[model samples]
Target: MKKIIAFAGSNSSKSINYELVKYTVSLVDDFDIQLLNMANMPFPLFSEDDERKYGYKNSLVELKEDFDEADGVILSVNEHNGNPSAYFKNLIDWISRLERKFLEDKYVFLMGTSAGKRGALGAISVTENMLPRFGAKVENVFSLPEFNMNFSAKTNTITNSNMEKEHRKQLDDFLGKLIKK
Candidate 1:
């Protein structure tokens, strides 16, 4: 079975991005999905001084291994004032140090979700521009705004039918791209 890693870009224990990612992962077929928590892969704030002081964080190694071994990745980022959450950005920074092109030629579905109107659009744009530079294929992208209003966590369903339909199309498109690669 093809293995995929799913994760959110937020450290909040109750992150809406995490909820959306889990929901998206559950809908995937014919893939072995592993959900990872940003909190579990903690890293020091990115800085030359920190790197010199504590060396590489263990979480970095674990994350690198997961990314290296996975055939694909599904990521849903949480926005903080129109940018990626600090924790997620820190993880990216550290990982880049270890492998400048960790996502090179990799299949990735970059997405984001939020309770606001923009639905983490800001973070999505930034990542879309940046991840490719790091060699991420970034096969597809989506944003779910007002996530709490559109998705029912307990039931694991998208409450709005139209949005769900559109998202399903995008997800199917992403899967097709991955399979073809």
Candidate 2:
């Protein structure tokens, strides 16, 4: 079975982006899905001094291995004042140090969500553009706006019919690529 890694680029335990990742991957079948939480994989803020002093951690090697082995990625990023969260940015910085193209040849289904109406669009736009620089080809993008009104934690799915339709459509397209020759 093909393997895909799903993660939300947020440090919060109760991230809306994480909820979106779960909802998106729940609809997929017959594939190996590794759901990761950045909160569980915490690292200190990236700094050149730290890298020079400590070298690379063994954990970083294992993390790189995960990226190398995956066929695709499911990433939902959090917005912090119209920018990617510091935790995610720091993670990327560390990962990039291991290899410039750590995500090379991987197809990514990118998403973001927020409590307000903009739906983390600003963060998504920047991430979508920057990910390619690290060699992730973003195949699809979704932004779930007004998380309180649109998603239900009890149901573990998108509550809004129109948004759910679009979300599923995008998810299906990304899944097709993984299952396709």
Candidate 3:
């Protein structure tokens, strides 16, 4: 079976982006999905001085291996002050130090969500543009706005009909691309 890695970029234990990514992964069929929580894999704030002093951590090496082995990736980023969350950015920084092209040639399904109307658009857009430079073939992108109102935790469903339709369409397209590959 093809392997897909799904993760939310936030370190929040109750991250809405994490919930959104999990829900999206449930929509996919057949693929072996590995769900990762950034919160579970704790790392210190990344810094050049730290890298030079401590070298790479074992966890970072393992994370790069995960990216290398997976056939595809599903990443839903959380935004903070119009940027990717610090925790997520730190992971990226550490991962890049280990392997600059870690995501190279991997099919990436990028997504973001927020409790507000903008839906973490700034962060999502930044990732969409940047991933391609790292050689990731981003298959599709989706943003869920007003997440609390649209998504129901109890039902694990998008309550808003129009948003649900749009989400399904994007997911279907992503699945189609993965199937083709």
Candidate 4:
């Protein structure tokens, strides 16, 4: 079976992006999906000094192996100060140091969400722009805004009908690409 890697960039215990990823992966039926929670996998605040002092981490090598084995990735990033959260950025920094262009042409569905009206669009934008540099195709993108109002925690799904349609469409489109190859 084809494998899909799904993860939220946030490490918060109550991350809405994680909820979004759970709901998204539940919609898939054909592939073997692996859901990774960054919250449980702790990393040091990345710095040049740390890499120089400690060298590569075993966890990052394992992470790169997962990326290499997967056919696609579903990634939802959390926003902080109109950018991808520093925690997620730190993960990228450490992983990229392990190997350049580590994503290696995987099809990626980039997503984000927030309590505010902009849906964490800024973070989504930055991630989308940069993933290609890491060899991610970034095949689709979605942002859910006013997460509390648009998403239902009780039901674990999107509550707004219009947003639901677009959300499914994006998933379908990304799936189509994965299936075609």
Candidate 5:
């Protein structure tokens, strides 16, 4: 089975993006999905001083190895002021330090969700534009808008049929590519 890393790009205990990630990963029929927690990672702000002081933890190195070991990635991001949550960005900063093109040649299913109608479209757009610089081969993207109304975290499923179908199609496309590799 292809191993995929699924994670929400937020540190919040009750992140909507985490719910979306769970929902999205459910559509995958034959993959071993490992859910990663941002809250578990401990690192300071991205600075040369911090880098030198910490010298990268074993967890950070292991996290990078997780990415390197995966066949693909499923990312659900949280939006903060039309950008990725600070915790996610900080993770990216640390990851890039280990490898400039951290996502190079890796298949990524980029997605985001928010409480508003736009979902996390803003953050998705930002990631789409910039992640390629770090070698993100983002093949598909999805955004869930008005998350509170359309999705229920307790159920761990998308409520709207149309939205659910759309999400499935995106996941199928990504998985299709991943399996072909």
Candidate 6:
């Protein structure tokens, strides 16, 4: 079976982005899905000085192994000030140092969500542009806006009919690309 890694780019214990990622992955079928929480793989704040001091940390190696093993990735990013959360950015910085092309040609289904109307579109756009530079084959991008209004935690469903239709279409497209040889 193909392996897919799903993660949220936030350290929040009650991350809405994490909830969004879980809901998105539930729409996929017939794959080995590994849900990784950034909070669980805590790393020191990345810096050139830290890199020089530590060389490479064991956490970076483990993260790389997971990325390398996965056939695809599903990522839901949390937006903070119209940018990726610090935790997510730090992970990217360290991972890039370890392997610049870690996501090389890996099918990536990118997503973001927020309580506001823009739906973390800024972060989503940035990731859509940046992931490809890291060799990610970004298949599709979706941003859920007004997340509190559109999604129901109780039912694990998108409440707005139109939004649900749009999300389903994007998910189907992403799944198609993921299974293609």
lDDT, ranked from best to worst: 4, 2, 3, 6, 5, 1
Candidate with the greatest lDDT versus the true structure:
4
Candidate 3: residue pairs that collide: none
Off by over 4 Å in 5: none
TM-score of 3: 0.96
lDDT string, candidate 3, 100-164, tens digits: 89988888889999999999999998888888877799868888999999999998988899989
| lDDT (C-alpha) at residue 57 in model 1 | 73
Q: Which digits, one per residue and each the tens of the lDDT, describe model 4 over residues 1-181? A: 8899999999999999999999999999989999999999888998899889998778788998998899999999999999999999999988888877888878999899999999999999999998888899997999999999999999999999999999999999999998986
Assess each prediction's global lDDT (C-alpha) against the native: 0.86, 0.91, 0.89, 0.93, 0.86, 0.89
Query: How well does candidate 5 match the true structure in TM-score terms?
Result: 0.95
lDDT tens per residue, model 5, 79-157: 9998887888888999889988867788999988888999899899988887889887897999889998888777888
Q: How far is 64's C-alpha from truth in model 4 (Å)?
A: 0.9
Count of steric clashes across candidates, in order: 0, 0, 0, 0, 1, 0
- Candidate 3: residue 137 lDDT (0-100): 95
Please provide, for model 6 over 1-181, each residue's C-alpha lDDT reduced to its tens digit, 9 standing for 90 to 100: 8899999999888888999899988888899999987778788888899899878888789889999999899999999999988888888999999999999989888899999999999888888888887899987888899999999999998899998888889888887887884
For lDDT, candidate 2 versus 4, the one ahead is 4
Candidate 2 minimal-lDDT segment of 10 residues: 172-181
Winner on lDDT between 3 and 5 is 3
What is the TM-score of each predicted model, taking all chains together? 0.95, 0.97, 0.96, 0.97, 0.95, 0.96
